[model samples]
Target: MTDDDPISLPAHDWPEFPPGLVWLVGAGPGEPGLLTLQGLHALRAADVIVHDALVDGRILEWRRADTQLEYAGKRGGKPSARQRDISHRLIELSRDGQRVLRLKGGDPFVFGRGGEEAQTLVQAGVPIRVTPGISAGIGGLAYAGIPVTHRDVNQAVTFLTGHDQTGLTPAALDWPALARGSQVLVMYMAMKHLPKIADALLAAGRRPDEPLAIVSNATLPGMRVLETTLGTASHDAEAQSMEAPAIVCLGRVVLMRQAIDWMSQLQGNPPRNPDPLGGGARTTG
Candidate 1:
């Protein structure tokens, strides 16, 4: 083939996608373009696909015409499929010789319960492969102009879920420890209990006025970033009527957004470089 030909590479360069096995893939945070090449390959090759609630439906447009799509999304307080049932279904599909694809939103291993499903499959002797995707904690925050780490701000960052399996604040989390130890905190699925979670952080000595940002529907067309503080996050979120599938970040990194809010700049807003810390402007000799 000539250099200008679209099909210049041989088919052998592609990896083998064997049947009767399951691939756990992360679809990334809401953006269809964020889906990895491996994930797209599996989508086109798999006989069946079991996906989560946060996955963008448009990503499935590339799937084969005969691909079987199964919805196993779990949203807090919404009627959804049970995790146990979903895991069992994967095992059943694999045993039936189907090339199953367990697709999840964000990194499957990051608060996606992918480990549990993988364990279940291992115990049942089902073969599996794992593909990592850009997590909302990282990608979504970037879309809102918030970085998880910056040398001038913090050296450590913590990522945690706002709730546990019971849909309440994770009781097992040592709130005081996290409050005292972490430089930056990135939370997922915490909006429903923002009041309680905020109280815990405050009680553990986090400043009420600490810079905090809530990014909803991150990386998607409807994305919104709310600039607030630890003290007013819950109230502001309520007042603004923010929705779920959001990422909440706290610490000086949130302030950096003022200088590098690229998304807003793309929309014609000017960049801002405000004082992240309230130490006032510096004076040099």
Candidate 2:
């Protein structure tokens, strides 16, 4: 493809992507450097890139001059392009013999609506590639100095969405089971209905004092981490004011922020040792 053509990596740097397929590549949580090697290769080879709102912009700047970039972000509580429309657009681009890359924030299948898009492409007889990235549930929390798993803390981790497609608390919500079962609960799109969700968790058996942490813009310069508890998640979210694309983690592991938080150390603000198992200091909001 010539320079005027959609973006593409040269024959040497990027491998050629099949023309008849769409690649679903996760952009990771925030840091552009966190992109997987395969993910970067696809971005460089793509003729057309349809990226979400949260996909790291720094990463997109790496696209070849021939690439075509389109915004298909579906932000919560905002007028969003229809999911069907986005899927069909991918199909159209591929049918035109263009290599399309659907770049999403975090893992595509991790509440990124990647499964729905893949289903649409499959039904239309289009081929696809799924490249995984670091999900915010884990990566985001990590940046805030929190660990989702520690032998001494949580033995299992459960990831869930804070809102359903209709923008409510995942109406078919099963709070009781989630509260009673998981050791660590990581939530996406949680900033919106955090209060209600936290309440439900408490009412369903989660200890009111259970530790919780919210990390916003994980791995990015503006990233902020709020350490709270199940009962205070909503209130602290309000007081400190977190926003969309943030990750919420709840469990004994939340208390680890003071112990093994490596990101802060990298930023030169390492958390003080607070004894994860002791401090009644539950972070919120």
Per-residue lDDT, model 2, residue 4, is 56
Q: What is the TM-score of each candidate against the true structure?
A: 0.92, 0.90
Candidate 1 on 88-141: residue-level lDDT in tens? 999999999999999999999999999999999999999999999999999999
**Top candidate by lDDT:** 1
Which one wins on TM-score? 1
Q: The CA-based lDDT of model 2 is what?
A: 0.85
Q: What is the lDDT of residue 68 in candidate 2?
A: 92
Against the unseen true structure, what C-alpha lDDT does each candidate score? 0.90, 0.85
**lDDT over C-alpha atoms for residue 223 of model 1:** 96
Model 1 alpha-carbon drift over 4 Å, by segment: 1-12, 274-285
Error of 2 at 237 (Å): 1.1
